[model samples]
Target: MKTSISKAVAPVAFVLALAFTLLLHGAVPFWGTPTLGQAVWTTGFSHSFVNHGLLPYAYDFGAPAPASIAFGLAGAYPAALLIALGMHPADAYAAMVALWLTVAFVSAWWLGIRAGAGSVKSTLAALAWVTMPVIWAHSGYSMLSTGIALLPFYSLAACMLFLDDVQGSRKIGRALLYLSSCLISVFMDGYSFMMFAMGSSIVAAYSFVMNHSTRRRLLTYSLPVHIAGFSLAYVLFALYIGKPSFGAAPLDFFRGWGADVTFFLFPTQGIHWMWDTLGLSVPRSHRELFGDSSVWKTTYLAPLLIAGLLGWLFTFSKSRIASAALIIAVAGLYLSLGPSLKFNSLVPQEIIETGVNMQHMPAELAIAPTGSALLSEHLPGFKNMRASYRWVALAAFGLWFLLLLWLSKAETLGARSAAAILCLAVIGSNLPHPQRYLEIPASNRAQFKAIDTMLVDDMREALQPGEQIAFLPYRNDFLVNYLAPSVPIRTYNIGGDKNLAMARENWPKTMRQFKMNKVDPAFADRLLWLLAQGEADAVVLPYIDMLWAAHAWPGGKIHQKQVQPAIDRLSATGLVDIDTREYYAVVRLNATARVLGQTALQAKLRQTLCLPGFCVRQAASSNAIHSRVGRLSANTLKSDGRRGFLVFGPYEPVESGTYLLVVWGRAPVPAGAWVDIVSSRGSTVHAKFSVPRTASRPDNILLEEKVVFDEAVDDLEVRIFAEEGSRIAITGYELRLARSGPDKD
Candidate 1:
C-alpha cells in the first residue's frame, strides 16, 4: 500500500512543478535586459538567414565570421521559425523558454529514476533540481546559461554507458543516448559543454578505478561516441571562426570570477529575506559579493536538502557511489573557491586604511592562494576557465545522486514519510518569491510597435541596396535589434573600444588624418567625406538625449550634452536630412563636397552674431555690444573685473584666401586689448591695439586686421583678450573672406 502511494507521487510532483514553472515564466515573457536584447538579435539573425538565405555567421559588427557560433542556435532557430510563422518575437522567445523548462523537468526525473530512487523521492529530486534558485536566477539574466537545465539527463546517459549496468542492445542504446546528449548540450551553450566535459571526466575516472571491465567498455563504446560528437562540433566551429584556439583570456579573469566561500553560507537577497527576519545579520559587503557572484551561488543547497544529503552520508558511508559523490563534491567546492582564499573580515593593513573594512566579522580568519590558482598558472587550458563557480553544476549533480541513493536504501514507511517532508522543505527553501519576476520591467506592446515602425520600417525604406549606414554615438543594442535582418544595409558603430580599434585598422588613412587635424571640426567633415565617398550611404543620429534620460546611468549627462551639438553641426553640412523626427534624424549626402563645405562655412559665419557676452543687444537686427563688470545679464553672461579671453569659431575654412576682420569700438578711457586669429593647421596671427583716451567720450575707434591662409585650413580659432578694468564696448564686428579658387562659392 505504501509502495503504491509512493509510485504515484513522482508523476504528480513532476506535473505540478512543470505547470508552476510554465505559469511563472509564460505570463511574464521578458525577464533580463541583456538576455532579452541578445534574444532579439538572435531572432533577427535567424529570420535574415531563413528569408534572405544570408550566411548565419556573417555579422554587421566587427567579428570575423561565426562569433556567435559558440552561442549555438538551439533556442534561436526555433524562435526564428515561430517568427516566420507570424508569431511575435517576444511570444516566440517565451515558447522556447517553456520548451526548455519541460525538457529540464523530464530529464531530471529520468536521472532520479536512474539513480534508483522511489517514485516520491525521484519526484522530489527532479523538483529540487528544476526549481533551484541558481537555475532560475540564471534564466532571468543570462538565457544562455539556462542550458545547465540539460545536465541531469546527460548525467543519466553517462551513468548507463560508463557503469556497464546494462548489457547487449541496452548498452548500445545507452551509448547512443549519451552521444546525443553530448551533441545537444554543445548546441545549447559553451558553458554547458564545459560542464558536461568536467562531469563526464569525473564519471570516467570513477568507472576506471572501480572496474577494469568498465574501463574496457568505455574505450570501446564511450570513446568513439565522444570523439564523433566533438569532431562534428569542431568542424562546424572551424567553418565559421577559421581556427579554434584557447588561452585568449588572462589568468586574472579566472581568479576574479571564482566563487567565494561566503556564497554557500548565505543565500542571495531573494532568499536572504527569511534569514534577515530571523535576526541573522548579513554583511553589506558580503551581500554585494553575493550579488556579483549570482551564478556561483548555485553551490547553495537549501538547509533541508543539505540535511538529507548529510543523513544519507552518515547512513551509507561505506557505499561506493556515496564515497565517489563525497569526493566529487569536495573537489568541486575547492575549485569553485578560485585561485585565492579570503574569508569575510580578513584584510591587509593597506586595504584597511582605505576604509574598505570587512563586514559581519568572525574571530578566526585567514587569506591564502588556492589550489585552483596554482593549477591555472601552470596548466595550458585551465587559465581559459573564467567562471570557476560554474563547477557547482557538477557538484549539484553528484549531491542529488547521493541523496537519492540513500533514500533508495530506506524501505520503511517512517523513512519514506521523513523523506517526503524533507523534499517539501527543499522545495520551500529554494522557491523564489513572486517579487523576483517583477523586479525587471516587462516590455509593453506599444514599445515593440514603436521599435518596428520608427526604427525598422524607416531603415528599410531609406537605405538603398548595398548601401551601409553608421549611427552617430553608436549603440550596439540598436544595431543588433533593428538592422540584423536588413542584409542589404551594413551597419557600423563607434560604440565599443574594440569597434573603434577595428575602424582605425580598416581606415588607417582617414583615422590618421582625423587624429592629426582639428579633432572636433574635422570630425564632421570626415564623416561627410566618408559618406560622399560611398563608404556609407547615410548617418543616423538618434535622439540620444531622450534615450539616455530614459535609461540614465553614469556618463549619461555628458553623452546628452554631446548629442545635440554633433547633430546641429552635421545638419549644417549640405547633407540632406531625409528623415527628421523628435526621436532621430537621418542625414544623407546630397551635394558636391565643395558645395557642402561652403554651406558649412556659411553656417559658421551666421553664428558669429550669437557670441554670448560680447554681443549684448539686437538693435535694427544687428548685435549692440555692452561691456560691464560684476553685473549678470538675463543670459547669464557676466564679466569679472579681471583679465579674460573669449574664443569663437573652431571653424573649418571653405577655401584658401585672405580674410579681413574689423572691430569697431569706443572706450570711456584708454585700455589695451589683443586679437588673435589662430589656425589649427598654420601659425597664429596676433594684433594689438589701444583704445585712445579722450577728453570727450569717443564715438567709435576702427581696428582692422588682415590674415591669410595658404590652403583651405581645416579649423580656425578666433580669440579676443581684454585687459583688466578695461571699459570697452564693441558696436560692430565683420569678417570678409576672399575667394581664391574657382570652386569657391
Candidate 2:
C-alpha cells in the first residue's frame, strides 16, 4: 500500500512541479512578459527562421548572422512555427520558455533516477533543480543559457560511460546518448557545452586515475567514441558557422565578471530581505561589483540545501558520484573567481593596495598564475570564456546533484523529513518576483506598429526596385528599432559610426556642398548625398528627441532645440519634407533641383545684419563669403565693434568672366557711410553709393552691379565704409557668372 501511494505521489509531484516552475517564471502557458536584452536577439533569430529557412545567412536589417551556429534552431524554429500559427512573438517566446523549463525538469528527474534515486525522491529532486535561482535568472536574461536543460542528462550518460559497468548493446546505447547530448548542448549554447565538457573531463580523469583496468577501458571504449562524437559535431558547426574568430580583450574584461566568495554563503537577491533583518545582509557593493554581476546572483543555496550537501559530504564522501560532484563544485567555484582574486567587499584593503606583482615572486610560483587567467591565457578556446560568474551554474548543479544523491539514501523517518524540508526550501529560495521580467508597454508596441506602417510599409510600396532608404542620426540598435518591417528594404545608417565614416570617405563632393560654416555638416550632407547619389530614394528623420521623450521612463517632454538646426538645414536644401508625423519626418530629394552640379549653378548667401548696437565685420579670407556656385566669395566674417562697417570678400573669380554681383544691406547708417566695390589691382572704386540719413527705410536696401573683368583678376573686394558713429550691415549677397561670355581685354 505504501509503495503504491509513493508511486501515485511521484507523477502528481512532477505535474505540480511543472506548473510551479511555469508560475515561478511567469511562463504560465500563453501569458508572460518578454525577456529583455539578449532575448531581443533571440526574437531576431526567430524572425529570420520564419522569413528564410534554417541556417539563414542574414536577418534583422541584414545584420550578419549572429552566433547562429552555436545558437542553432533549437528554440527558433518552434517560436517561428507558433508565430505562423498566429501567436504574437512575445507570446511565442513565453511558450518556448515554458517548453524549455518542462524539458529541464524532466531531464533532472531522469538523471536522479539514473543515479539510483526512487521515483518519489527523484521527482522531488527534479522540482528542486527546476527552481534553482541561477536557472531562473538565466532564463529571464539569456534564452541560450537554457541549454543547461541538457546538462543533467549528459552528466548521467557520462557517469554510465565512466563509472558504470555496461556491456555490448547497453554500452553502445550509452555512448550514443552521451554523444548526442554533447552535440545538442553545443548547438544550444557554447557556454553550457564548455561547462559540461569541463565537468565530464574531470570525472573521466578521476575514473582513469583510480585503476589501471579503468584507464584501459577509457582508452579503448570511451576516448574513441567521445572523439568521434566531438569530431562530427565540430564538422557540422564549422560548415554552418565557417571559421571561428577570436579577438583579444583587456585583462579587466576577465577581472570584472569574477564572483565574490561571499556570494555563495549569502541568500540570493530573492530572499536577501530575510537576511537583512538578521543583520547577516549581503552588501550592495558586493552584489553589483560589475555591470554583468547580476548573472552571479545564482550563488545562493538555501540553508537546508547546504545542510543536505554537508550531510552527503560526511556520509558518502568516498562514493564515485559524490567524489565527482565534489571535484566539479570546487573547480567551478575556483574558476568562477576569474583572473584575479578580488572578493568584492571581503578583499582586504592591504591586498588591494599591494596589487599582484609577479616580478618579485619566487621562480616556481612566478610561472603558475592563479584563477581563470592561466586557462584564459594558455587555453585556446578558454580566452573567449568571459562572464566567469556563469561557471557558478556548474557548481550549483553539482551541489544540487549531491543533495539528491544524499536524499536517495534516506531510510529513517527523520532523514526523509529532512530531505522533504530541504526540497521545499530550495523551491522557496528560488521563487523570484514576477516583476523581474521586463514588461513591454502597450504604447511602445503601438509606436512600433505605427513606425512600421508609416516608414517601412509606405517606403516599400513607393520606392522602385533596388532603391534604398536611410535613417538619420544613426543608432546602433537599428535592428530592434525597425524590427519586422513589412517590406524588406536594404537599410543605410544601420552601421552607426562606421556608416558615417564610410560616407565621409566616399562622398567628398556632397560633404563639400553642405559645409556651411554654421554647423557640423557631416550628418546632414551625408544623408542628403546618399539620396542625391540615388543610393537612397527617401530619408526618414525620426523626431529622435520626441521619440526619446515619448519612450522615457516616467515620461519626458520633447526638447528639439539641439536637433532643430539640422532639420532646418535639411529643409534649406532641395529635399522637400513629404510627410511629417508626430514622431518622424519623411523627406525626399527634389528631382527637378540640380543637386549634382550645384557648384556650376548660381549660389545664394544670407546673413542677419546688425541693429543699433551690434555691428558686423567680414574677414579678408572668409570662405563663407565665397559663392557656392561661382567660388568667388569669402566666408571669413568676424564682428568688428559695437558699431562699425560690414565688409565682405577679396573675391577671386575662377575664370576671366563677366559677372553679376547683387548685395543686400540693412543698417542705421550716418551721412558719410558708403558702400564700395573696389578693385584689388588698384584702389580704383568700381562702384560706390552714399547712404542718406533721411531715407525712410534705410534698413531695406538692395544693390545690384554688373562688373566686366578684362582678365581673370585675383582680387575684387566689397567694403561698407561707414563713418565713426555709423553702423552699416551687409545682410546678404548673390554671385552669378554672365550667361554669354567673358569681357575681352
Candidate 3:
C-alpha cells in the first residue's frame, strides 16, 4: 500500500511549514515587515494613548475601533521584547511563505492518503501542491502575518471531508473543531479565508455527488451549524468591530462589475469596494490594476492556476469531486458578478417607489454564503475579510484534492498516467492564463522623502516656542498627521474623509479642486487674491485626488494657473513649495522645524490647545475687567450686590502651572476702587492700588479684594463672593493675569 510515502508527506509538510515560519519571522523579529493592507491598519493602532484605556477614536482623531484589534499586530514589539523573539518580521514572512506551502502540500497528501491512493501517490501529490502554480505564488510571497495559521485550519477541514465517522462525542467534537477552525480562519484575514472557503466548498459538493452517503452525513452534521456560526461570527465582527454602515450612494453599481465571472456568479461592477468603506461598484478594468503589487504577486501561487490547469485534464475524468469542484469554481465567480449585474444605482428608477431607492447590493446583501456553505474551504485569515472569493479557493482545493484521490485510486493504471501528469504540469507552466499582475514595489511608497527634509528644515528655522505655524489647504490629518509624528505641526482638521475647514480656509482654490478638478484662471486668480488677504504659515494646494471625484472636477487649467503658481511664489514673508514629494501638496507650514523643535511651548499645552497638529487656539492674558449686567428681578447696581460675573479671564497660560487668585467682596454702595498685586517673587508687595471702590465712580463692574497670589498659577482670577453671600453675582468680570511686574514699570 506504500504507506511510507504517505507517512513522509505529512512530516515533510510539517517541517516545511516550520521552516517557512522561521523565514517569515525574518532577520529582525521585532522589526518585521508589516502585512499587506496593514499600512492602513497601522494607523488604527494609535488609540492606546488615552488617560482612560479606550477612547472614541484612534489618535483621538477619528471614529473609534474596537480595542485590542490593531494593537495585537504591534504585539511583536512587546512580544519580541518579552519572550525570546524568535523571528524578525522578515523571517516571519519567510515562514509564512513556507507555512502556506506546507499547508497546501499536507492538504494534497491527506486527500490522496484518505482516497485509498498508495502512500507513494499521496506523497507525490503533496509535492505537487508544494510547487503548485498559485500556491507557489503564496509561498514566494506571503501577505498576512498569520499566514502560518492556515495549516491547522486546512488540516481540520480535510478531516471532516474524508474521514468516515460513527459515534456521539467524536461527531460532536469534529463539528466543534470544524466550526472553531472556521472562526479562526476568518479572524486571521477574512479575505484569505474567503478564498479558503470557496475551495473547501468545492470538495463538499464533490463529496455530495461521489460519496452520497458520506455527503449526507457531512451535510447532516455540518451545514446548519457551519452556516449559523459563520454568519454570527461575521456579523459580530462587521457590526461591532468594523462598524460598517451604509455609505453614501453606490455610484458604481450601474457600471458592469466585470466580465471574468469565474470567481463567482456575481457581476464584477460593484466588487472594487466589496469590503471597503465605500462598498460601491468598481470598474472591471481594475481586475489587474496592481494597486499594491505585492498582493498581486501573491495571487499567482495557486499551483493549479490557469497556466497549469491543463495538467489535470488526464485525472479530471476519474475524479468526480475534482470535476464538480471545477464547475463550482466557475459558479463562484458569478457570485460577485451577480451583484454587479444587479447593482442598485442610488438613482431611483420608475419601477421603484420614488425616494425609496433600495441601495442594498451584492456587498450589502448576502451572496457568497449560499455558495460558500457548499463549496468553501477554511482559509486562515478568511475571517478578517468578507467572504467573497472563498468559494473559488474551495473549488480549486476540492479539484486538487480529488486529483490526488484519483491518483491514489489508480494503482492499476501504472506509471504512464503519472508521467503524463508530470508532462502536463511542465507544459502547463508556459500556457499562461493566470498571469500575475505587474509589480512595481515603488508604487507602495509615495515620493515624500524630499519634502520631508524640506519640511523639517523649514520648521527648524522659523518656529518659536509659543508661535504656531498653521498649514492651510491640505488635510491636516493626512499631511500633518503623517508628517508631524515627532514635530509639533498643527492642523485645522483631522481624519474625516475630507476636512471641510481646510477647504473653506483655502476656499477659492479648494472649491475648484474638489468640485471642478480643473485649473481655471479665474479660480486661480481668486486663490491668489485670498492668499494676499493675510500671511499664513503656508497655504497648500490641491493634488490629483481633488479631481478624482466630482468635487474636484475642473482640476486641469485651474490647478496650473491658480494652484501651482500660488505655491511657487516665495515672497520674503512667505515661500511657495511643492509637497508632491509626499504624494500630496499643501502650503508651507513653519519657517523651520528646528525653530519649532526648540520652542518655549509646553508639550502638554500643545495637546490641550492644538487639535492633533493644528493650532486652533492659544493662551494669552491681559488687564481690564469689562462687565455687562442683565436685569434680574432686583435689577441694576441694586440688592446686596449678589450678581453674576460675565467674566473673560487670562487665557490659559502656555505653560500650565498654577496660582489661584480670588476676586470677592461686597460692592460698597459706592466705594473707591483699589487694585493691588503681590510680587511673583515677593509676598504682598503692593503693585498698584486705586482708592477703594468709592461712591463717586459708581462703575458698572466691581473687582474683589484679597486678590492673593499665594502660589504659581495655572488659571487667572477666580470670582469671589461678598463676605457672607453666595458666588460672585456680578454681571460680568475680566481677570488680568500675567508673568509678573508692575504696569508701566
Candidate 4:
C-alpha cells in the first residue's frame, strides 16, 4: 500500500465506522434518538449544561462534591455542545455515540499501523475490534462505551512516549498526547483508566528491566507525563471531589458478579445470532448450569481472537511489549475471577470418589476465598472497586494488541492464509443480526411526557432560583430530568449514579407513613425534618414518571399505589401552594413551612432518637453513605429464641443533665426485655430498665428509666437487650431533659 494512501485510510475508515454505527441502530429518526437506560442520564446532563451551565458537584447517590469525580462529563460535554448548536438532546446523544465509536475505530487502526501491521490487515483488525459483541453489549451505557473507545488512544500515546526510537520533537508531541490522554481518562471512566494504569505499570516494569533504551525513555518523557498527569488529577479531585477512590463494593457482590472462565472463550447467549439461528441451546443452558444469572457474561473474546491468542502463546518471543501483553492479560483474567476461583462457572474443591478410585469432578470443586476477595475486603483501591469482572477490559485490549503485533510478522503465503481464515471467522462470529438492532426503542418514547406538555415559562415562574425540588420516586427522576434544564430548576436528585439507593427499595415504608388516613405524626415529623435537612423547597410527584417507570422499572407499581396518598397528605399539611397537573403535581414549600419544619426538627433532634436496624449496615458497601440523607429505611429486627442485643447505638446527649428515657416498643412473646445506657468505649452499663410484660399497643412504650449524667459525656450509647423467645418490636426512643440544673448529691 502507498504511504499517502495508508495515511488517508484512518479518516476514510472512520466514515465507514460511523455509517455502520448509524445503520446498526437502524438510523436515528428526528423525533427520537437511539438511546435508552443509562444513556438518558448523560443526555439529561447535557441538556442541563446547555440550558443552565450546571455542573453537578454531587452525583445521584453520592454526597455533594465536585463534578470531576464522576464519569458523565466525558460523554456529556460533546452532547451538550451539539445541543447548543441546535440539535435535539436525543439526537445529540446518538451522534455522541457515533462519534466516540468512530474514534475508537480510527485510534485502533492508527495504533495497528504504528505497530508495523500492513494497512489492509490493520484496517480489518480495527473493524473487527469495533464490531465485537462486547462493544455492542455496552451500547446503552455511554460512559463505559466511551471509555472503551478511548482505550486504544491512551495505549498509542503510551507506546509513542516510551519508545527509545522516537526522539526530539516527536518525543515532546507524544508527551503532550500522553498528558491529554491521562486527563481524558480521569474525566471519562475512572475504572477503565485505573485498569490502563495497572496494565501500563506491568509493561513499563518489564521494559525497564529488559532494555537500556526503554529505561532511559521511561526516566525522561514517561516520568514527566506521569508527574504532570497524576498531579493534575490529584489536585482537581482533592479540590472538588475530595479523595479519588472507586465506589466501595461488597465482597459478596464482587464474587457474584465476577467473570467466569468459560465466558472468555464463548459468546454470551443473546448477543450472537448463531445461538438462536443454529438451534444452539448449549450456550444458554451451560451458563445457567453453574451460577446465578448475576455472573457477568459480557467479557467474551470471540473464537477468532481466542484462537489467535492461543496460537501466539506457542510462537511468542522475548519481545518486551509482547511478553508484557501476555502478563497483563493473565493478571487481568486472574483479578477478574474475583475472590473465588471459578472455572466454567463452577468452583473446584473436593475430589469425587468412585469405589476407592478417586476422580476429580469440576462440579464438586470450590474455592471460597480468592486473593481478590481478601484484597477487596482490606485494600483501599481493591475494596472500592467492587466489580472485579471489569478487569476483563484490560485483558481484551492486551489480547487485541498482541494479536496486532503477531499479524505484523506474517509475510509468507501460509501465514497470510491462516490470518485470513481467522479474520473471516471473527467477522462471521461477531456479526450482529439486523433484527437485534431493530429491537432498540426510540428515545423520544422513553422521555418524560410532562416535558412536552408542561409550560416551561409557567414552571419557571412557580420556582425561584437556587430553590431545590425533591422528586418522589427518586429513581424515575432521571427520565424526567431533561425538564430541569428547560425550566432551569435546581433539584435534590442526581442523575447517572447507579450506586445510589433505589427509591422503590427504600420508600414503601416511608410512603405508608405519609398516607393521609394512617399517618404517623412522629414519622411525618421526622420526614419533614429530613426534607428540611435536605434543603428541599418543593416536592414534585411526577405522575407521568410513575406511569413510564411502571413499564420500564422495578418499582412502578408501588410508586403508583403510594404517590396519590402522599399527595393527599401533602395537601393536608396546608403549608404550601399545590399546582396539580394532569401528568404531575408540584407541592411548593412556603417560607413559613420551611421555618416551622426547621424549628420542629431541631426540637425533635434534641430529645427523641430512633435507631436503625443492624441490617442497614449492609449499605456500607455502597457509596450512598457519603450523602447526609442517604437511604437507611425503617426496618424491624427479630430474634429467634436467643438472648441478644437487637439494637445498639452510640447516641450522644445534647447536654449533660437528668433525662427521662423511654423505649417505645412491644414484646409479643411476653418475654423479658430491658434497656441499657452504656458507655460507647468501655463495656459499662450506667443505667438499666427491666420491665415486665403488659397489655399495650404493638408500638407502645416497653421500658423507661431516669438516667443522670453529671458532666459532658461524649461516648454514651443505648443497647436494647431481649430475653430468649422474645419477639420485640422497637419503634423509637424518647430522651427528654427532666431538669436543667446539674445533679445534686
For model 4, state the Cα shift of residue 475 in Å. Answer: 5.2
lDDT of each: 0.54, 0.56, 0.36, 0.58
What residue runs in model 4 are displaced by over 4 Å at the alpha carbon? 1-14, 22-34, 51-69, 223-235, 281-295, 310-320, 346-380, 438-466, 473-477, 480-483, 496-523, 528-534, 542-557, 564-585, 588-745
- Candidate 3 off by > 4 Å: 1-105, 116-124, 130-163, 166-168, 188-220, 242-326, 332-395, 413-420, 423-745
Q: Please provide TM-scores, in order, for all candidate models, with all chains considered together.
A: 0.68, 0.67, 0.44, 0.73
Pairs of residues at least 3 apart in sequence or in different chains that clash in candidate 1: none
RMSD of each: 10.7, 12.7, 16.5, 8.6
> Candidate 2 versus the native: TM-score?
0.67
The alpha-carbon lDDT assigned to residue 464 of candidate 2 equals 45
Scored by TM-score, the top model is: 4
Please give the range of 10 consecutive residues that has the lowest summed lDDT in model 3. 612-621
Per-residue lDDT tens digits for candidate 4, residues 1-745, read 6778867886676567556655564335343344554555665667766654545432322222223324656677888888889886667777776677667777888887886776677777787676665566655555776676567877777777665467678777777887777777767776677776777677667777877766766776576676687577646644544445545755566675677676766665566776556654234442233333323445776564474585466336624578777787778788877777665653222211122211111322435556676677887556755667777777777777776666666667887667656765766676666665665535333442324444344566665655666565555345544545556566545444442332222332333223222323243343444464555667666554532442243223344344666666656765556787544667765566667667674454444433121001112122212212112235334445567766565444335667677766566664776767777454766788775575566557667778776665555666666676766665556556665456664
